[model samples]
Each structure stands twice: as C-alpha cells, then as structure tokens.
Target: MSSIDIQHPHTLAPAKARKAVEEVAKKLAERFDVEYGWVGDTLNFSRSGVDGKIALQPNQLHVSAQLGFLLGALKGPIESEIRRVLEERFK
Candidate 1:
C-alpha cells in the first residue's frame, strides 16, 4: 500500500474552511468514488481502495490517505492533484 499525506496552511475562518473542504470532498467523491463526512473538526473519507481523514486545525489542514495496492500505483499523481487543489482552495 502507499500513503498520501499532505499538510497545508489556511487563512479562512473555521466555518469557511469547513465549507471549502466539503466542496472539495464532493469533487473527490465524483472522481475517486469517495464517501466523506465530518466528525468534529475532522473529515473522514473512504472508498474501496482508499481511506483518509482531513483534520482541520486552527491554522492548517492535515490530510492523510492510505491506498490499496491497485490504487497505490497512482500515488504520485494523486498526491500532486491533492496538493494542487489544496493550494487553489486555501489561496
């Protein structure tokens, strides 16, 4: 298995950040077949070949995902896309 972990800084208020993440989650669901929901300030998400959590903090967003064998092969691109989206959203 491979791992995709990313931490990003943000400037939005908690509520705005939550909204931004939820929107990103929806987009991810469409592309990656992921399911996600909030548990306190964290968003937990998963699919058949992937599981992850997005931890929303006072000044940062921490994302961690574990990919099963098949999906693991695409880790590089996946991580890149994640970083791209995060950069776009947090800007």
Candidate 2:
C-alpha cells in the first residue's frame, strides 16, 4: 500500500485544531465513506483500502493515510487534495 503522510505545524488551540480535523473528516466521509473519531487526542479514520489518523498536538497536526492498490494510482491527487484542505482549514 502507498502511504500519504502529511504533517502541518500550527499554533492553534487544541479545540480549534480538533474542529479543523473534524471538518476535514466530515468532507472526506461524504465522498469516501470514511469512518472517523477521536481515540484520545488522535482522530483515527479508515475505510476499505485506506486508513489514517490525524494526531492533534499543541503545535502540530499530523495526517496520514494508506492507500491500497486500486486507490494508490490516484495518490498524487489524493495527497494534493488533503494538502489543499489542510492549508485551507488550518490557516
């Protein structure tokens, strides 16, 4: 499986960071059927052929996803979108 791991450092409060991650999760779920929730401070998400987590820290938001064979082919666009969304929301 190909992996998409992105770490974005931020100075936002934990609550705000969580909210941002939640918004991304919601949008992802709409199109990808992603299932997600908080496991302690980490937002874990998964679906067939994909799995990842958004680890919320005081000054950093780490996002990671693993794509299976079929989906791996689209890794570039997928990663790009994730980057775009993170930049948009976490700004």
Candidate 3:
C-alpha cells in the first residue's frame, strides 16, 4: 500500500475548520466507498482500496491518504477530487 499526504492551511477559526472537516468527510464518504470517523482532532477513514486521516487544526488542515491499489490506478483521481472538494469547501 502506498500513501500520499496533502495538507492545506486555512485562515478560518477552529469552529470553521471543524465544519469544513465534517463537510469534506461527508462528501468523501458519499462520493467514494470509504468509511470515515472522527477521533479527537482527526478524522480517519478506510475503504477496500484506500485509507487515510484528515487532521484538522485551528489554522491548518492535513490529509494523509494511503492508496492500496496500483500506483496509478486509483490514487491520482481520488486525490484530485479530494483536493478540489477541500479547496471548494474550505475556501
């Protein structure tokens, strides 16, 4: 299994960050076949082909993802979609 970590720093407050995280998680869950949960300050998820953590901070957001499928199979598209959604929601 390979992994990719994508981080985005936001200028929002903690409350906004939390909301953005939840929104992103819900969208990702609905769009992809993944299981996600909030544990403390981090949101974790795993599907048959992918696993990752979405860590939220007051001024920063970190997304650490692991793709278990082939190198170029599912990683690029999923990562792109995740990035787009995060940017759209958090900005």
Candidate whose TM-score is highest:
1
Q: Using Cα atoms with residue i matched to residue i, what is each candidate's TM-score against the true structure? A: 0.95, 0.93, 0.83
TM-score of model number 1:
0.95
Per-residue CA lDDT of model 3 for 1-91, tens digit only, reads 7777888878888878887788767876897766889899998988777778988877778998778756437777767987887787776
Q: Candidates ranked by lDDT, best first? A: 1, 2, 3
What tens-digit string does per-residue lDDT give for candidate 2 at 1-91? 8998898878788888888788878988998798998899999999999988989977988888889998899999999988888788787
Candidate 1 lDDT, 21-86, residue by residue in tens? 999999889987889999999999999999999999998999999999998998999899889999
Per-model CA lDDT versus the true structure: 0.93, 0.88, 0.79
The total of clashing pairs for model 1 equals: 0
TM-score of model 2 (CA atoms)? 0.93
Candidate that would win on lDDT: 1
- Pull out the clashing pairs in model 2: none
**1 versus 3: better lDDT goes to:** 1
Error of 3 at 38 (Å): 1.1
